[model samples]
Target: MRKNRNLIVLNIIVILGALVMVFPFLWAFITSISPGAGLSSTPQLIPDNPSLSAYVQLFDRLPFGKIVLNSLGLAVLTTGFQLITSSLAAYVFSRMPFRGRNVVFAVYLATMMLPMQVLVVPLFVEMKTLGLIDSYLGVLLPSIASAFGVFLLRQAMNSVPTELDQAATLDGAGHFRIFGLIVLPLVRPALATLTVFSFLNSWNSFLWPLIILRTPEMKTLPVALAGLQGQFTTQWDVVMAGSVISILPMLALYIFTQKYIIQGVAGTGLK
Candidate 1:
């Protein structure tokens, strides 16, 4: 009976936590439908007359579709490139032993300690020198390789048993074949986890895109959304509408990869 009571309490706590996390998205959705509502106005769980005027205004006033496409394109490219580069590097670090490999990897991992803020000026100068300013390539070049992704995938790869690689070798499988057929399949959960993280990072990127993209048409969703705010009187409803829209892709991606994410976290020994 006591165990049953404990389970009930745990369930209640979980439900309450879920609600707390969900409240902001719920409020954003509500505010998006509440036309002309400002953040200063009293909070209304349910507005008197909910309409999509804010979304309508957003689309009419801004090139929201193009902005969303730009974000999606950049995010997809960044995630794909990161996955490829990180996976290859992870494989090398985990399987291929070489002189000074550990030292090199340590140095690479140390780059993660340096925040993007510190790299911005140097990256901008480099982009300018390369004449890639205001181009998609400039925005993309910096994000193609991710130290975090390499670390995560390398951890996952290390967890794979080396016996399998040896057996594949006995079967006349080359390093390329073994890596492709054996290791890659086993670490799928980690790959999915990396994919989600890479996509999220690229999607929400503001600083780099803000600095590189000069034309309004080239601006991604986050940068474009920032333009909506006025100096004195901001439109809360429209801002909320954009926020809701920006969230849908990420929410969908998470929902689709939820199982893999859990498995990946557990497999990697991460809390």
Candidate 2:
């Protein structure tokens, strides 16, 4: 009976926590459907007469389609490149032995500690020197590789039994064959997790894209949505509408990959 009561209390707490986390998104959606809603308006769980005029105005004011495409393209490219690079690097770190390998990987992992803000100036200058400023390539080149991806994949790869590699080697299989046929197939969950994370990072990326993509047509969703605000006045409805739209892809992706995310994190021994 005591245990049952504790479980009930825990269930109630979990429900309350979920509501707390979901309230902001619920309010955003309500505001998005509430025409003429502003920042100063009273919060309402349900609008009196909900309309999608804010959504209509969102597209009218911004090149939203192009912005969405830009974000989507960058995110896809970033995820793809990061997967390839990080996987290859992780395989090397996990399977291959070399002098100073651990030191090199440690240094690489340490780079993750340096915030993007610190690297922004140097990256911008490098982009400028390469004549890549205001170009998608400039935005993409910096995110093509991720240290966290490398670490996560490496950990997953490390957990794989080495006897498989040895057995494949005895069968005259090369490193590439072993990687593709044996190891890669086993780490699908980690790959999915990385894909989701990389896509999310690139999709919500604001600073680098904002700096590299100067033209209005090249702006990503986050930066373009940010422009909805004026210096002194802001339209909450249209902004909320844009926010809701921006969140849909990520929400859908998480829903789809929720199982893989949990499994991947668990498999990797990550907290």
Candidate 3:
């Protein structure tokens, strides 16, 4: 009886904790669809009368679609670039024997712990010199090569059995062909997780874009969302609508790739 009671209490505590964590998202979601007026005084989470006016005004007041497209474009392009660069680097480090490979890999992984903010000013000056400011390439450049991705893929690649690579090589396969045909297929789960994470990070990046993009046309989702705030009183409902718009894609991507994400982590080091 004591154990049963203790379990019940613990479950209740966990449920309450989850609700506490989820409360902000629930509020943001509810408030987005709510009309702007009387939002502050609403005694309940769900509006007395739900409306889509906030979402309507969000796009009508700004180029919401353009910002969404820009964000999506950057996310997709950056993810692709990182996947290729990191995977190749990881494969080389894990499989190919070369001089000073451990030393180089150690240096590379150490660099990942360094914050990108330290590099932003120099990156900005370089972009300006190259006339890349306010351009998509400028937004995508700093994120193209990722050390986190490299570390992750290196660990994943190392787990892949050496037998597969040897068999491929025996059949007259080159390194590139072997990677493309055998190693990549074996690490599909890791690639899917990496792709989803890289895409979300790119989509949500705000500070760099705000500093790099001067024109309204070049602004991505988070920057454009920040623009919803002004010198005067902010539009709470519209801001919330924009917030939902930005987060929904990430949620959808996570949902779709959740299996791969968990499986990738679970499968690590079994070989």
Candidate 4:
């Protein structure tokens, strides 16, 4: 009876937390589906007419399909690159022998403490000097060397049993082959976690893309969404529509990855 009561309380708390977290998305959702321009007056929880006008207008005003493709491409590229670079770095830091490896790893980990804004100016100047200011490569370059991913993957790799590495090496496999066949498969959940993180970070990137992408064709969804906030007025309904679409991909990705992401953390076993 006491356990049942605790479970009931926990359920209530969870439900309340869910509602609190979903409030903004719910508000934006209702606003997007509502027919008229403004959602301020007597905004019911559900849409009155429930028209798709805002979403239609959102696409009409912007090339949404193109933007979605651009966002997907950028996110996939960034996530893919981060997985390779970070995993290699993690593998080397975890298992490989090298002079000053610990110190180098320390420096790499230390980079995570530096907020990205501190390096933005230098990065921007570097891109400008390379004539890549408005290019996709320019937007992606800064994010490729992900310190957080390296740290996370390194910790995950550390948790892996070294016996597996020895077994692979005994099979006449090279260090790279051992990593590819043994370590990577074992840490798939961790990779999934990092993949989702990298994808979301790249997809929702605003300030860097804003500075780098000058042209409409080059603009990402987040930067394009920023234009909805006009100088004198804001287009709430249409902006919300764009926002909903922008977030949908991330939501879907998260849903797919949540189990693996959870398992990944639990796999660390230091909890």
Candidate 4, residue 65: Cα displacement in angstroms equals: 1.6
Per-model C-alpha lDDT, please? 0.96, 0.95, 0.86, 0.88
List the pairs of residues colliding in candidate 1.
none
Task: Give candidate 2's whole-model lDDT.
Answer: 0.95
* Tens-digit lDDT track of model 4 for 148-259: 8988888899988999888877888998898998889989889999999899999998888999988897789998898878897777888989988988899999999999
Better of 1 and 4 by TM-score: 1
Q: For residues 55-85, what per-residue lDDT tens digits would candidate 1 score against the true structure? A: 9999999999999999999999999999999
Model 2, runs deviating above 4 Å: none
lDDT of 1: 0.96
Worst 10 residues of 2 by lDDT: 37-46
| lDDT at position 254, candidate 1 | 98
Which tens-of-lDDT digit does each residue in 125-157 have in candidate 2? 999999999999999999999999999999999
* Deviation of model 4 at 219, angstroms: 0.5
Ranking by TM-score: 2, 1, 4, 3
- Scored against the true structure, residue 173 in model 2 reaches a CA lDDT of 99
For candidate 4, what is the lDDT? Answer: 0.88
